[model samples]
Target: MYYIGIDLGTSAVKLLLVDEEGSITSTVSKSYAVEYPRPGWSQQNPADWWEAVTAGARELMAGVDTAQVRAIGTGGQMHGLVALDAAGEVIRPCILWNDGRTEEEVCFLNETIGRERLSGLAGNIAFAGFTAPKLLWMRKHEPDNFARIAHIMLPKDYLTFRLTGEFATDYSDASGTLLLDVEHRCWSAEMLEICGVSEAQMPRLMDGAEAVGTLSAAAAQELGLPAGTVVAAGAGDNAAAAVGCGAVAAGSCNISLGTSGTIFIPSDGFRVDAHNALHSFDYVEGRYHLMGCILSAASCSGWFVGDVLKAEDFDAEEAASDPAVATVDLPYFLPYLMGERSPHNDTAARGAFVGMRADTSRAQMVRAVREGVAFAIRDCVEVARGEDIRIERSTLCGGGSKSALMRQTLANVLNIELDLPETEQGPGYGAAMLAMVAAGDAPSVEACVGRIVRMRGSVVPDPQAVAAYEERYQIWRQMYPALKPIYRQMAR
Candidate 1:
């Protein structure tokens, strides 16, 4: 049998076809535009997402036997607030996960409502990207639209609803909304009241691998797939990526360097960090995981190379760099281009280049961008360490992981072994694995992951590079705290 995995990303929807054996057969991607109507605000139309997925599915299944397809699952960008009216039409363009227009709402939740109360109810503190803050923003700013919110869902759950005619969400995705009582695995009544939302607005919750419903006849005809194909309750992008890397077992770790970066550590039991630096969310495999997310990762380098330097070839740039100079006299870069999450949940924080000299070379700047991302990831590692979760080694995946320089830098910076997966499809592959379980081709999410996910190789930390990064990271840590006052002033 064949299964389809859809990764509904920030900029595109990637669909992958996998056979019963877990080998990927074909893949297709459909791109959509993200709108920045105002500075620090991001939005996307739900109609565009449905249109892309349908078109991409047709392309993915081209010349293939659609009758052989048994199930479909998705891993999507999480925390975006997609609201629907009574008639099931999208009330407005989704407030995207990276949108930072919720500063007032976040402050209201954290300072006014109190972080301890919010954390006790939702297992997390308010961040600008979370759905609760977005909801509050809408209520205060767009009251008419807020009043029409009959149903609320995340980005991927909207796709699942379109396919199965079911309003359902996986625990992994729901946990990020700052609405779920994550420790209890349910929606918090207190949080619902605080957000001025009712429980009825929420979607039915399920484990990521559990089948929510089958494809509707209309959806099946539209996509050229068999009717009644099971649709699983898919996960948030990070949790899905973790499953793809076989990071479901307790103490297992996975680091992703996509547009955003994360340090994910799966746990057998629920555990919240004292500082609430790491997100405590339900895992796709019916366990729990702590995740620390940085707002930008590979995008930092992308910005430096593409936007700043106007260069397209990253590998060539790295190849041409002076290896001797690359290792010494490097400037520090604070990669808070979209503000920061995890460790420091400061939305006012902005990116900056500190300790730059007049003679700073492009290669040195490039190295700084890469190393800066590594250091930001190390910040999360440090937080997890504070919680006594020792993440000595982790599986790494995503667009940034493709760079050898990044892989080596990350390994040395964190002083941890980095394992590269044979198939770095990340969320797409993980969604496919969830589909396998939903279709009964696999027993459980963990077993399916164990059978399929393979590590290609590991990057062991070099002693010399590790020592050098240790010193640099200490200096890098001080940069953020020193700039906190400036960031607040700049925001005002």
Candidate 2:
């Protein structure tokens, strides 16, 4: 039997074909453009996603036995608002997770509605990227479109609807919407009223590993797949990635350094931090997890190298940096290129190169970018530590984890061992694991994860380097607070 995992990302839809034994046999990726209609307003047509998925699935199953494919699961970018009218046509371009146009709505929710009340109702504070604020934005700015909304779903959920003709979403993905009472694993009526939405607008909730529906005949024909293939309720990208890294059990931690960075800590019971810095949400495994996200992680390094330096060879540039410079007093690069999320929910926050000297070299700047991201991750780890969550080590995955220097930098910066997973496909792979559970190929998520997820090696922190990074991190921590007022003023 075979299972397919579709990761509907911001830039692309990645499909992974995995067998019952947990080995990936084939993969396909289809890219799409993200529309920026205005500054800080990111959107994408839902039709574009369907187009990519159909094209990618055909390519992924070209030589494979279509009859053998049993189940399909998806993992996608979270908090995107995909609204549909009563006839099921998309109301407008989806407001993407990275969009910052909900600033006014976020302020209204966090300040006017009250942070304490919001947190109590939804298990999280309002951030500009969450779904509720975006809904409120539409209600205020695009009331005509908002009024026509009959169904609301996340990005991946929309794809599932297209495939199975089911309007449903998994708990893990819905947790980021600020409309779910995450602890109860259901929609919050209070939050729904506040967003001026009804419960009927929300998708039916399911566990990530549960089968939402079978593939429709139309969808099967479009993708050249077998009809009646099981479609599992998929997870948000981070939760799905956690399952990929075998972070389903309590006390398990996973750090992803993709376009964004996240420190995910799984717990058997739900717990919210007093500061509300970390997000308490339902995990893909039906428990709970705390996630701390940095808006820009590897993307910051990408911008520095590709845009600023006009360099394409990232490995070579990263290799050029001297390891001995770990002890040197270097400039700090705030990795808030797209503002910050966790701990500091400041959308006005901007990236900066502080303490740069005339003598600083390109390699030093590169090192700074890496160190800055690592430090920002450390800030998140500190919040988890404050909650008494002991993270001695964590499973590391994502594009940034491929860099040995970055692995070492993160290990030292966090002063913890970082384990590299054998299959670092992240969300796509995790979605496949969920498919396994839904298809009865695996008894449970934990059992499936244990059998599939393998650790390759560990990156241990150097004592001296950890001490050096500690001092540098303390200095870097102060830079954000010092520049906070400046960023707000500049925004004005």
Candidate 3:
């Protein structure tokens, strides 16, 4: 039998076909544009996402036995707000997760509403990228659209609804919405009231592994799948990626380097830090995890190399930096191109290059871009360490992980062994595994992950490199606080 997994990402939709043995049989991707009508705003048409998923699914299942396909699951970008009208039509472009237009709303939540109360209610504080801030932004600036919101869902849940005719979302995805009472696994009544939304506007919440419904006949026909194929309530990208990397066990960690970066550590109990710097969310495996998200990661590298440098060969550009000079004099890049989340939570934060010399080469700047991202991830690791979460090792996956330089830099900077998974499909693969559980092809999430996920190799930290990075990280850490005032001024 076969299962289909969909990864509804920021820039593209990726579909995977996996057999009962957990091997990927086919993959298809379809790209779409992200609209930016104004600075700090990011949006996408829901119609664009649905069009891409259906097209990608048809291509993925080409020449495969249709009868063998048993289930469908999805792992999607989290926190995006997809508002729907009474007739089930999209009200407007979805406010994407990376959009920084919620600064005012975030400040209102964190300051006016009080972070302590927000954390107590939602198990997290408001950030510009979360779904609650977006809702508040809409109610304040686009009141008409807000009034028409008969239903609200995340990006992947919208796809799931289209597939199964079920308005439901998994806890892993809902946890990022700031509307969920994450500790108790329900929608927070106070939060809903604060956002001027009712519980009726929310989708039904389910565990990530639960079967929401079967595919609708129209959806099955459009995607070339069977009508009765099971559809699992999927997870947020980070949680699903953790499952893909087999990081479901207590204290096991996974670091992702996709469009956004995250350090995900799954735990069996629910716990929140004193400052609420890390997100406390329900994991795909039905427990809890702490995750720190950086708004820019691989995309920073992409922007530097492609847009700033106008270069096509990323490998060649990355390969040009001198290792010796890199450790000593290279400028520190902030890696905050699209503002930031996690410990800082500053939407006004802007990317900058500090300590640059007159003779600084482009190669060194390129190296700084990579090092900057590594340093940003280290910021998260340090927070986890504050809570006594010792991450001696972690599974690594995503587009940036394919770079040998990035892998070694991350290992040394983090001072942790980074494991490479044999099947590095991340969310797409984990989504497939969720489908298996829903179909009874696997006994449980843990059992399926244990049987299928395998490590390909490891990248151990170099002691000397670790020492150098530690010194550099200390200097880099001081830059953010010093620049915070300037960022706010620039925003004004």
1-492: candidate 3 lDDT, tens digit per residue: 999989999999999999988999999999999999999899999899899999988889889989999999899999999999999999989999999999889999999999999999999999999999999999989999999999999999999989998899999899999999999999999999999999999999998888999999999999888899999998999988998889988979999999999999999899998799899999865699999999999999999999989999999999997484246566999999999998899889989999899999998899899999999999998999998888899999998999999999999999899999998899999999999998888988999989999999999998888999888999999999999999989999
| CA lDDT for candidate 2 | 0.92
TM-score of 3: 0.99
What residue pairs clash in candidate 1, if any at all?
none
> What are the per-residue Cα lDDT tens digits for candidate 1 across 389-481?
788899999999999989998999999999999888999999999999998899998889878888899999988878888888898999999
Per-residue lDDT over 294-408 for candidate 2, one digit per residue giving the tens place of the 0 to 100 score: 9999998899999999999999999998476375478889999888999899999988998888898999999999999999999999999998889999999988899999999
lDDT of 3: 0.92
Clashes of each: 0, 0, 0
**Whole-model lDDT per candidate:** 0.91, 0.92, 0.92
